[model samples]
Structures are given as structure tokens and as C-alpha cells.
Target: MDIVVAITLFVLALLIGVEVIGKVPATLHTPLMSGANSIHGIVIVGVVIVAAHATSPLAWVFIFLAAVLGTMNVVGGYVVTDRMLEMFKSDKSKKGEGK
Candidate 1:
């Protein structure tokens, strides 16, 4: 694919993603984050596939960076989701301790 076409598609995707995500309700954000993390996991897999074809030091560096960033995104999403879930749990342990 031509570089110009690829860049145009990327820009369009970015704009659409931002618009869609911006409209999501706050209550649904955790689920959205979880879904995004799954997408990022696919991105990491793509990075690994790309790494296999890398022929230069710069390409290797970019692949490595992509992998690291994707991993961080997945981990961070899970942490956020976990914290959100914790908010909904009852403090049963605390109540029992007070008895």
C-alpha cells in the first residue's frame, strides 16, 4: 500500500476511535477499557509478527517498544477494571471485624 493511503487510513481510524470513545458513558468505561485491552493484546501479537520480518536495528527497536507499550496498556487496563469492581463490593470483612 502507498504511504499516503496508509497514513490517510490511520488518521481516519484515529478520528473515528476518538469520536466513538468520547461518547461512551462513564458507567461503561470499565468494560470499554477491558475490550481495548483485548485489542491491544492483538496489537502485541501483530508486533511479534512484525518483529519476525524486521531487517534493521530501527525496526527491531520499534517492535520492542510496541510490545512494551502494549503490555503496559493491557496491565493498566486490568488494574483500572479491578479498582472499579472493588468499588462495587460490600465491606463485609470490615463489618465482621467490627463485631
Candidate 2:
């Protein structure tokens, strides 16, 4: 029952994430993604909880995967946001030249 509910909610979230909100403007997207990325950092707390409570081998494996995936989210999000910021910086330079 819990698994069914979780899967249902996951699918609903995935659909909304991919289809519903993807039409926003590019300028809006960077800030939205940066905010969402901050929320993704909460995965670290979840990973810690899972790690501390894990007992079975399968549980340990899942905990390890969570740790790795969470770390990737933290690092990848920063890289992407930094690149996005650079795009605006270059645009600023172009505008300055025209002034």
C-alpha cells in the first residue's frame, strides 16, 4: 500500500514536472531551477536518516546510492547555475559595449 501510494505520487510529480511547468520563459527557468536545486539539497538529510537506520544489505546498498546521488545533485546543480550566471554576465558585457 505504501509502495503503491509512493509510486503514484512519484508519477504524478514527474508528469507535472516534465509537462506542466516546462513552458515557462528561459529567464524564469534559471531562478526556478536554482530554487528547486536548493530543495534537492534536503536529500542529504534523507540520506543520513536512511544510513543511520539501515540494517539489511539491501538497505545499505540503497543508502549508498542515495548518498552518491545526493552528492551529484549538490555538485551538478552548482555547476549548472554557475554556467547560467556566466551567460548573463557575457550578455552584460555585450550591452556595455553598445552603450
Candidate 3:
């Protein structure tokens, strides 16, 4: 059934996301975040699919939560990436001296 497939995919994605969060080292975290930002774009497709086909109040609630979570992933990922990149400004750049 469609519900079974959706649940399976969601669980698989959740497990893989947890594993990825656990294993990534601090030094690699920024690059990991950039990659994650790109992944959030994929979640857009899921949002659209859920929005178009949701048939019941419970389904609407689930879809709303999914949309909010997906949006947070996207916004948080970009914010983290931007913050990481901001930390890397060279001394010359700080002095407004970059070529």
C-alpha cells in the first residue's frame, strides 16, 4: 500500500539522517551543512506531493508538520552554512583590504 511505502521511506530517511548527524566530524560539519542545504530542496517535492493529495484532517496535520520540518531543515541548514563561512574571513577581509 501507499501508506506502507511512505512510512518505509520516511523511516529510512530518518535513520540515515540520524546516522549522518552522528558520524560527521566538527571540521567537516560546514561542508556537511552545505550538502544538507541542497538536500532540503528535495524535500520540497515531498511537500508538494503531500499538499496536493492530503485527504483527511489527520493527513493535513501530518502534511503541515512535514512542511514545517522540511522548511526548518532548509532554513537551518543555510543559516549554519552561512555562519560557518562567516567565521573564515581572513584578516585582510576584516580590514576591508581584500583584492
CA-lDDT, candidates in order = 0.77, 0.81, 0.77
TM-score ranking of the models: 2, 3, 1
**Candidate 1 Cα misplacement greater than 4 A, ranges:** 1-26, 30-38, 91-99
Query: What lDDT does candidate 1 reach at residue 13?
Result: 92
Q: Model 2's lDDT to the true fold?
A: 0.81
- TM-score of every model versus the real structure: 0.53, 0.61, 0.54
Which candidate gets the maximum TM-score versus the true structure? 2
Clash totals, every prediction: 0, 0, 0
**Per-model C-alpha RMSD:** 5.6, 4.6, 6.1
C-alpha lDDT (0 to 100) for residue 10 of candidate 2: 92
> Given candidate 1, what's the lDDT at residue 87?
57
Which stretch of 10 consecutive residues in model 1 shows the poorest summed lDDT? 84-93
